[model samples]
Target: MRGGDLVVRVLKYLVSVAFLALPLAAQADELQEAPAPDAAAPVPSSSDTILVTATRLAIPVDQVPASLTVLDKPAIDRAQDIGVTELLLRTPGISISRNGGYGTTTALRIRGAESEQTVVVIDGVKLNDPSASSGGYNFANLLAGDASRIEVLRGPQSILWGSQAIGGVVNVVTALPAKTLEGSFDVEAGSHETVSARAAIGGKTGPLAWRLGGQAFTTDGISALAPAFGGKEADGYINRNVSGRAVIELAPGISADLRGYYASSQTEIDASTADSLEYSLNREFVGYAGINLDLLDGRFRNRIGYTYTDTDRDNFNPTRARAQTFDAAGHNRRLEYQGAFAIAEGWTLLAGAENERSRFRSASPPAALATPVPAPVRGGADITSFYGQLSAQPIGGLTLNAGLRHDDHDRFGGKWLFAAGGVLNLPTGTVLRASYGEGFKAPTLYQLFSEYGVASLAPERAKGWEAGAEQHLFDDKLVFGATWFQRKTRDQIIFNSCAATSTDALCFVPGNATTRRQGYYANVSRAEAHGIEAAAALKLGSFQLDGNYSWTVAEDRSPGANFGKWLPRRPRDTANGSVSYAWPFGLTTGAAIRWSGKTFDNAANTTVLDAYTLVDLRAEYALSPSLRLIGRVENLFDETYSTAIRYNALGRVFYAGLRGRF
Candidate 1:
């Protein structure tokens, strides 16, 4: 009866089992009075509408204005047997952190920000990693079965993405080409002896069309963390990945794409306590090419890009025999063109322009003459942005969205971001929304020239606002939503306290000499993140009840700090729910629950972590008509908690897989 009364008795037993399964999920949607003569038959797809391109404009996630989440492609082939951080932690303000297991180096945080402030795009290029000391994009060596869809955009998208997006954006779209001539393959074995395999092929000649795929995974991990100078043994780790992609339609609407990827991993670090036999090996390589054009008679659209990233880090220790290699490489080329003009009836017009350049280099391996030596850096940066957006519907159901962007930075020089949103369509299918935005982030190169034994760094900025409402009942089968937000930041590059003497040689520095970080940082701070989100989806027929609840009060008003604490890791309550079933013998069952509340880990909120709930179960069986067999049981009551706070999570896990189509 401790730990806040066991998180209030597990949130009162999940709100009393979601109100006792709400009358058997509302009597399984009534309509069973003898109607069985070969019933389950309906397959003619052409619109249940769920198309999204994360606002690079290709709307329809209920007309996206913001806060979008889509995981299509049959839910990524039914969660491909878990571990893309368990399918993005079952979504809902996403959060994932891993320091060990399944490829190490995995971190993603959204809504509470950080992880290079979120911006990872593939197929539209931009995959962070410039020696990623923080420009995040190590989706733990991403190989989620060559993702065909994954879009998550939540709050502050820097006005159509520019500059780390200030906490939002994750797009990985791939797989297209093959209207016919198909293929498929799979193999699996699980439970810590995990063996896996996947394959694919597609075609169409003359007028060209193509598709290709590949996958490989390995694991031996679990157990490795004990080195703030201590000891630990048998760290266990291994991972490998390979990928390839191609799509060409060339002509009649033009299309072209090429992709290649490589990954490598190894980890085991305790690095001290008389050197507990240390180890660390990390490697990554990526290449991409793109082109998409569809013109006028088709409403004009164009995209061109090139991207390459390389990373390598190797550290082996036998009592510091000194081997700590380093490598980081990046290249980006861009061209974008957009258009939409039906400027007469109900109006629509959007525009775009972008030019980018980035380069970086870092090298290390010259210290151990007993420490004290650092220097080896190279840098480059360029950005040119211009954007425009407008949408209108003068009357009928009213909707108007506006956007503007202008960014030019070679080094913190120009900024202008803006957005306006609206959605008001009420005739009982309610919806009324509002939005405002401006966000920015710039200054990294180890924050403008790295040097820790001698001090130097700076760059941070932001501004934002939002408002919303939505509802739909018994036709949309019950759905609801609400949102409110606000943000403010300015030159907030922190690490304060510098003013000391006593033969000051920067006072023999090595961090926190009462804090020393002010390389052009300004602090007139303010932060107020307000929120209230509610959702419901009920389509009873064979049982389906989805739910969501979020309540946040992220605060921080600075003068001397700690205005009302509660910023770091921002969690003031969150929830997610699910209850699904489909049984006519072919079976399909589901159950899910997730919750998080107490959060704080610095930023004056004073360390605290206690609030947790996670339960997941899934099942599917249909061994015919293109086969299917899936199973999942993650943390299903084996809960030993720790979604980060010394990090260690993965206690009750099981996965089964099988899929086929041809």
Candidate 2:
């Protein structure tokens, strides 16, 4: 049978199974609803609700305008058995592309969007590296233990956020101060000689509440294929990370949060022996502080935050005489103020303004010239933006949101962006939503000012629209949603071959033609991507089944370019599903599978990465109210596959650990 036919068959079987189990699932639900005379007044379950930061405004997950997914604390702990990359690989409509092992450079693409287009935020602060080829964050080095929750929002978010939000947003929110004294400590040892320890404490003193936490981890990564020509035994690398955070409640309506992290790793490049000759040592340190205040009779709110990050890399390549060393540093600071008030019987208004500034710098040694060259090149860029958003609820079950932003940079010119969206709630517990927005991304310092034998570049821009619906069924036991979206980008920075014409030979002219990318990117054409994302979570007695599927069709419409071709590294179809059973004995067993359809490796779609699937199994046993034992087997079938072409992927792995709370 053809691939399409197989897919249809599989889908049909799944639908049939779901229908056949409906009766049993319904009976289980009825039993759950049976009241217990002494059930303590039916207290609310903590797992029933989740809060998200997708809107910069804290709101319940179901109320968010766009498609949102929240991995809460309990979920995070259970998945901690695997690396962050592996856990994210299971998310719907998301894909991770890796260059090598766990700690190696990694990128995330959402809904056919490029890595540079996805924005990553830690505690509401953007973490894009200005010194990188593209202003994008490296997720490989992030520590998952410090996050209280991970919120993934799909679709363009430029109006509320600024640049680098063309694809979507991933927000990692850290733990906050608790009202009661609490503490926890955890330690784990697993495959690949991995070991880690973490501890946290929280307490309240009169009007003040505070929480502090720290973690340290180390690992010896798995082996893989070498890069370059003629490489060997691609193994033997060490990765280490340390992080800490603290939150303080200064008053009843005021709070401050401070966090610091340091991560360093010595890893071997999976290149040919000639390529392996280059060993890399990377080190990074980050510090941040934020303040929040609620005032004006609880109608006005304000937040101020600042962050500083420094990353240093020392690469020794035997093939090249000049060892490449990079000292990159960046700082981000922002201040936001918002207020909301009731105007009439059924009307409410919300408004906010934000001021943000970002700066980055990098220094690297220039490669040796055939003869002799001048000193290395050094430069940096600064950007400042002002933005505001408005939200109104003029009638029951109807909400309208609009936002605008202006960004001015010392390097790139100015950009103005805006978005408008609306949500309608039906009487049957369903919501319909639609949004249209504009997005912009400034050229990286490297793209604009890199001294590649003298070349210049320009910035990129995007426009997008999304429509979706969400429904709650079986009295909220099941939640389902579907969304369709499209985005078009302009002036996409690209490297074009330069013509060779040397006027002066005194500079020791290199190859036939000195290659340099031109900043003259044009609005060649447009890229259209439309997809349907469907997700459902059903709670049956003590068992839960959650699954999601995304089908996408992306085409490049630029004239003379790879028109009609699928975007590189984007899967046309993706799906994830998990089934968990919780026993009264305090044990939970679950298994999950993730699958991605075939994808292209380049814009022309000439080379394809075959479709693949991964399976993971996890079990957790509650030793007590304060401690638990968790174990998991990842890549259970030991399938060997590549998330990116020519990149090494982790093989079968197992982890066992213990977690506790007091």
Winning model by TM-score: 2
lDDT of 2 by residue, 1-662 (tens): 23244335434533443354345344432222111111001122264555565677654454456777777677777666435556566677788777667677788877777788898876555667666767688777776765667778788887666778988888776665454787777788777887777777777676555566766666666544533223345544555665555656688667776666667776666551233545677777667776655543333344545566666666666567675634455545444433333333323333444444455555665567353534544556655555656666667788777878777666566778888888888889898988888887777655554443223345678888889998988777888888888888876765443344434432222343444333222224467777888888898898899889988787777777598898778888999999999999999999998888898878888878889888999898999988899888888998777766766677787888898977
Compared with the true structure, model 1 gives a TM-score of 0.31
Model 1 Cα shift for residue 229 (angstroms) = 30
* Candidate 1 C-alpha lDDT tens digits along 1-662: 12243334334543443354345334443321211000010111246766676677665555556666677766666545434556665666666656545655677766655667678776556667655445567676676665667788777777777777776788776665445677665656566565667667776667665666776666554554433323234465555666666657678767776776666766664422332455667776667666655543343344444556666666666554455644455444444444443334445555555656666666665537577435666666667676767777788887777888877776666778888777777888888777676777766554444433222333456666666777888888777676766566555454334444443444333444544432222234455566665666777687778767777676676666687687676677778787878799887888888888778766787777667898888887888867778777866897655544554455676767776766
lDDT of 2 at 213: 70
lDDT of 2 at 148: 69
Stretches of candidate 1 off by over 4 Å are 1-89, 92-103, 107-134, 137-161, 164-316, 323-361, 366-374, 378-397, 411-471, 475-536, 539-544, 547-577, 580-590, 593-662
Candidate 2, poorest ten consecutive residues by summed lDDT? 33-42
Give the range where candidate 1 is weakest over 10 consecutive residues by summed lDDT: 34-43
Clashes of 1: 2
lDDT of each: 0.61, 0.66
